[model samples]
Target: MEVQSAGKETYRAKTSKGEATRQKLLDVAEEIFGAKGYFHTSVVDITQRAGVAQGTFYVYFPGKQHIFRELVEELSHNLRREIQIAVNGAAGRKEKEIRGFAAFFDYVRKHRNLYRIVQEAEFVDPALYKWYYRRLAEGYVKGLQEAMDRGEFRRLDPEAVAYCLMGMGEFLGMRWVLWEKKDVPEEAFRAAMELIMGGLEKRD
Candidate 1:
């Protein structure tokens, strides 16, 4: 009983070691949730694979669903961070979009489980799934709107354009990285770029 009481004290990560343990649980949850899926995975599965005590799992996440939610949120943050970093030095909207796509492809390659986890979120938690994409679109729309204001891009509905661009990136990544386990081929990438840049380019 005393040991259980002590373990409950770790409900949230308060120290560096605690944070590491929390992150480990999240990492393990990401893998299991991506592979076995939310319904199929169990807390014990994450704990055993993570080499942590079952109580430790509860310490970080209240339940399996909490961990799954955290995983999706974390992936969203990491993907956006990578894209931002990749596009920071890009000179213009065109370069920024291209570099952003490249960054996304690289991230998907490394985190292939991304597709499974996010897609499954639609069923597991519909609102969460929508939140995931909306969070992504918010940043994209802001960037597109900025370009439109600068006359770099056509003055169109930024949100609409953002979704279309996101769809293109999503399918391209799915086809090349997730399905074929290869980089998006040069031709496909070029076609995508041309479609995006040509359509959005401001005309005289």
Candidate 2:
């Protein structure tokens, strides 16, 4: 029994170490991929940049494509979480929409590299792009649907509304964070949200 327990502990330790190594590789890979792009980055580049063995990279990620996919998925997850937090904290539909937009734009500004990677993935891999957009669209749809159900917003197709909102957010994020060399001010995002919700809000 003692030997079995000790062996399990050793396995767990090794597993944890492997996961750490994998994450390190991914971190470096994301940086390089974002700077150099998916087509230009190689496994050797990641391993060298990450200070890990080439074989180690293969163990965690099959290749550059796999790493790109993982990066996209991770970014998507983070974006979703940020938006959810912002929306959940708001007191009303208008506030929720503003908060959601703020959270997304803030995230993009702070994580510009990751955002660029996401944009590249959209062009390089259609399937991954679809998956990313689907998740984003679903989040927006749910938020709009909630507002409509609460009688806080006018009647409309949640999915369509969500897409429009997301499109506007995406373009704003890209312009201020990705293409333009500056931080997006909070007021800018707030104004954009106001414009979007201006026509959509339910009048008392």
Candidate 3:
């Protein structure tokens, strides 16, 4: 009985260690992929940086492509959630849009490497590109449609509006925040909000 109990404890300890190792691999991969584009990063690089055997990486991911996909999916989910929270917490539609932009800029600032990985993946992986933008556009459309229905804005094609607003925000963010290596000021976000609101405002 004692031997059996010892065996069970050993198994539990091994499982815990395995989980920790997997997390470490993912963390290292995020940094590497962020710094080096997805196409440029390699499995060897990941294993070396993770300080694990090459075979150990296979235990958690089939290949580098799998890891890239996983990272993109994770980032996409996080961005969606952040945008949702920002929009939901606002008192008005205009405020919500501004907050949404702010949240996205903040996220990019915190995970600039991850952002680069995402951008690289868009060129290398069409599925990932479609998945990320589709989800993002859907969220924006839902928010805009809801606001319009509530009389916060004029009625317009939600899909078109979503695409336009997101495109504008993305370009502004990439130029000012990402390319310029500057933080996204609140005033910048407010300016974006004003431009969007002006276009969508209802005429009396």
Give a tens-digit lDDT track for model 1, residues 60-116: 887887787778888988999999999997999989988999999999999989999
Best by lDDT: 1
TM-score for all models, in order of appearance:
0.93, 0.86, 0.84
lDDT for residue 167 in candidate 1, whole number 0-100: 98
Instruction: Give the worst 10-residue stretch by lDDT in candidate 1.
Output: 1-10
For candidate 3, write residues 65-87 as lDDT tens digits: 77777667777778889888877
Q: Write the per-residue lDDT of candidate 2 for residues 24-137, one digit (tens) a residue.
A: 976897789888988888899999988998987877666677777777777778888988987786798888877787788788876778667877877777777777888789
Question: Can you list the residue pairs that collide in candidate 1?
Answer: none
lDDT of each: 0.89, 0.78, 0.78
Q: How many collisions per candidate?
A: 0, 0, 0
Q: Ranking by TM-score, best first?
A: 1, 2, 3
Q: Clashing pairs in model 2?
A: none
TM-score, predicted candidate 3 vs. hidden true structure: 0.84
